[model samples]
Target: MQAPINIALVGNPNSGKSSLFNALTGLNQKVSNFPGVTVDKKTGTAQIVPGLTANIIDLPGTYSLYPKSADEYVTYDVLINPDNADIPDLIIIVADASNLKRNLLFCSQIIDLKIPVIIGLTMMDIARKKGVEIDLDGLERELGVPVVSINPRKSKGVAELKKIIDLAARGNYSAAPRDFINNGALAKPVTDEIKKAVPGKSDYAALHIAVNADELHFLNIPQKAAIKQTLQTHQFNKTKVQAEEIMQRYNRIKHIMKSTVVETDPLQKQLRSEKIDDLLLHRFWGYVILLVVMFLLFQSIFWLASYPMDWIEGGFGQLSGWLTSVLPDNKITDVFVNGILAGISGFAVFIPQIMILFGLITILEDTGYMARISFLTDRLMRQVGLNGKSVMPLISGVACAVPAIMATRTIENKKERLITILVTPLMSCSARLPIYTMMIALVIPDRRIFGILGLQGLIMMGLYLLGFFMAIFIAAIMKLFVKIREKSYFIMELPVYRAPRWKNVGTTMVEKAKIFVTDAGKVIVVISVILWFLASYGPSSRMQPLHDKYEKMIAAVPADSPAADSLDKAFRSEKLSHSYAGILGHAIEPAIRPLGFDWKIGIALITSFAAREVFVGTMATLYSVGENPDDNNATLREKMAAAKWPDGRPVYTLAAGLSLMIFYSFAMQCMSTLAIVKRETKSWKMPLIQLVYMTALAYICSLIIFNIFK
Candidate 1:
């Protein structure tokens, strides 16, 4: 049996590492957590040769091996700890060819581990376009490794890269080490100490790590006594001494590049991207442009999704009506149509909005605008006791709070990250859209505010803004209580802008949609079925007698009586629904009575916890029960408008609708979100806290709204 070779893919952020991993492994990848940690671990297998399989692990992106955050720690630990279960037999250091200087910092560290390393130079097309020419043979000689230029997006050079991996695994390729130590006599003692500490480790890499101890914690030394003694004898601080050695290595790299690399145009460095970035990164217009971009993003969510949402709603309504006509009037039919089918369709109705939101985000990220957003938002974030990196999680909260919370792992400071996670759920997610749309349509007038902002649109925007501002406010308050001493910095690479990759955007949309439908869909289907059964059968013995009595009264009424037809329909529908099950619904009706909700609305709320959008479908299903075949006003909106309370008051008064919207906006109603939070946080405490806080807030807020309106 052939032994499977372990290969680790490492790179800086946005170096096309993920794209390369996807191309190499395809669907053979599995994402899990590192042992005892919530950090993501993505591993896959690629056939490196005719019979040998290579297990490829995509390590988290980091600038250096010295980790400050939980996610970064995983990468640092995996690389240095040989006792790790997935220790790589070979290391592939992926570098962005466009930014060689910064990329090389990581490569230099990896090389010091004395492992066989190959360089996968990504984005060579970008480098070529900028009039940069790399001497591959010279680079290989200087780095003591084979360098392969790959455009993973285009599937270029991947096969050759794989072949190189196979050869490296078989110990078939070796390059002579470049001379990095020019002052070997002066640094001999320190280098010897490092070699003794880590047996067989590269002297050059150890020297670099020892010098830059403050910047990146490469060495696991508990005390600096030995290094101090060496440094004192040499009259240098160990940190500065290590930095000087790294500079020596870089000087040699620069010398080699001067000989082998060429620039066709001297002014090619001042490119169009640089010119555009000057404006986009400017202090004033940069912020204005960011605001405008965000405004447009939110506007697109409502305006663009409106037509598709209507289509989904209409299509589902028609389907439900058709099912009612086709299926026999039996318990099973009722469960299938009213419970399972209706529930699934209800959740499916929100796919267009979710897809559009995800697609836009993916596009922004691909074009490097997300990093810009992080940079722009950093100052404001720092004011609220969060590092600039916190912006990533906050923005992610707009799509789903669970991943947003998980993304907080990138924030190095523990207190700041915890506070960010605690408040992220306040951001208006796509899940809240159905509730917002339904309630706004029902309550807020369709007119403009001051002849400028649409009233409904303004309210919607206010809700999102409220959530955002509240998150910051809460974080600020939490900052005063939590004690933290770690220093935070915002040193992020701003990649050159590029056109969005449609393939990546499309794949993201499909994947998110699949997760939503499958995970949330199951819970919704079960709930809807239970609700259908509850609403369908009653104490039929008592119900039948009461219904018969009403029927006879209608029969005994004078044929010419003006109220005969209307009275008979009302009496029959009521008696049929008012059986034992109906009595139970009525019993709970009074509990929700304070919020201007009837038992039916209570049922909708209960079922909608599976997903907020299911509220519309639940209402549609409930109101359609026992209706005649020719009933007009087929839309939920139309039916809701015509619905009346027992006292002849409107069931959907402006007060009730506003209260409902408030309730949905604040409720922790998504089971999938809860599950994801549990998975990401690695405990149920945080999610349980979220559930309690959100539910209480929703109830209190809705209660206040209903009472004030009443």
Candidate 2:
């Protein structure tokens, strides 16, 4: 019944902090927002010793305690505020052994907080490859803390890491005997005053609060006032103090490094990663490799998911048909089989494709190639009013725009970041994949050109490329109109390449697949139920008369005759036409008709505003209601393909499918994305403009595409 031991994992970005967390926690981790903020807080439970558990928190990656962005602030707040729920009983700083100096800066800062500390050195192999070696015992002696070398990706030294964490949690560990910086020398008066005001805080913690009092939300009005007064009285210059502390720390770090570590001359060595990057980062070859990667990604989305998607569709169809057969032919049976079941199956078939897409993305990230993608695209990004950093958010938009917009926080230039946010939605996210897949199958042939590339896969790749191109084009246009003047820069480290961790990759696949099914599925199912009711029932007066007329006509015709079947089809169509959904669709048909969409598609467009993926579910429910009993086991794709207008033209022809794809590629149909934009931009102005411009663009492009194809 003892409380779980608290351990926090902290590090600079790309220092293997995430890999360590994954190795320690395995499947026991959960991700949620930190308090009221939208930033992700990842926590997990690990058994650190016999009969004892440790609650490990993986904090946001930050370079220093002084934060410049929202994500960095979360890390700083948790570390400094003892009252935080995630405040650690022990701190394990994961440092990159390959890049010791830069990583040590953050570690040195954390140590000065006087917390119990342990250094988990990662990338030992990479360091060795670079002809660098560190003496662990020497490092431990110099820093006066427990130091362990680990490779989290390979799960090496994980047991040793756990033992260290357990020992520290039980109070068997202490901080370095020597502080990295002398707080009194930096600002004796301010530090002394803060210690008196905030009892039990270390000199480093008190100093941090004094310098960042205005930005610290936990401090009360009186405490902030007192800190401000103390700073003024002492004439404490925060910038000067910080610069002095950094120089002093680096000087000591250099002395420690000379005695504890050895490195070969850079001119004598070339790393494997460097050799690989020579080709991958080459000006002309880099672009070619990037394109090939993207092409294969879209291709795999279809090729890998094909079998599983078929299984899901066939399984659901059979289940629906079985339910229809066992249950009596009644409205309740219809609702359960057609409304709810059909809705679930409609989107479930897409899970395999989503999982594969995320799995590949995770692999690219783990292998360190993802960073090079930004480096390669920096020049192109500049042309569109963005820097290399914006490439991450824009590419991440392929998975989901809500988090992608949040990722823009890493971009330092406000104007460039805003422009990136405004156009990110133009990238086709996974939510649109189902829509794209269904439409492409409806119109595009299954045959492959050149005997290797499937036409459907090619079309899918084209849509994704189109979306990316449109995002950049829109960003260019926004740059002209947005009136903020700011300089932008892109600075990033290219980590040494490593093999993808299969455990991490598999975990991501399951988590993302689960999210799509549970989160997007909820919206699709609820909307499908409502859509079913709207499509099934109308004004009682009209519905009753139509039903009565159909009964008489069907009764007059012979059973199993073509005439009877024709009359039955006519009657069901008439009933649906008089229904509420039909009325709504008809009302909007005029507006969308010029782009090759009809009343039914208009209904889908309106309902799918809840989520882009709902368009598939809407079609499923609509078609299920009027579907011939003989075709009960038909897939949604088959049903959509069979649909025809009153004039005998197919509803989802080549022109209409292409037009719809183009529209989704350009339009901002995701409400969640819009809400996130408003939250990030701090007003409705940017989101409104984004919506209007994207919608106008979608409509105009669809108009042109539909006309050209028709």
Per-prediction count of colliding residue pairs? 2, 0
Taking all chains together, each candidate's TM-score versus the true structure is: 0.81, 0.98
lDDT of 1: 0.75
Q: How many backbone clashes does candidate 1 have?
A: 2
lDDT of 1 by residue, 1-710 (tens): 46998888999988989989888887688778889776779999987778789899999999876666777778776776556888788888899987777787778767766677899999887788778888888887777888998988788999899899878867886433543344444367776775666565566545644564444443455435565556567665655655675677587667766876787866676766678878888899998887667666666666788798889878877877787787787877767766676677667777877888889889998888888888887888889788888888888888887677778888867777777877788788877876777677777777865675566766777777767777787678778877656878877878788888787788888887887787666766676666666666677676777768777877887865866766656764685367443666577887778878877788777767777666766775676554443352266676778778877888898899878877776778777678877776678997898789878877888899999997
The lDDT per prediction is 0.75, 0.88
Residue-level error in angstroms, candidate 1, position 36: 2.5
Off by over 4 Å in 1: 1-6, 25-30, 43-55, 82-85, 125-132, 169-171, 174-269, 281-284, 441-460, 483-487, 537-596, 610-617, 624-633, 653-655, 671-689, 700-710
User: How would you encode candidate 2's per-residue C-alpha lDDT over 632-697 as one tens digit per residue?
Assistant: 788888888888899998988899999999998888888999899998888999999989999999
Best by TM-score: 2
RMSD of 1: 5.4
- Clashes in model 2: which pairs? none
Model 2 TM? 0.98
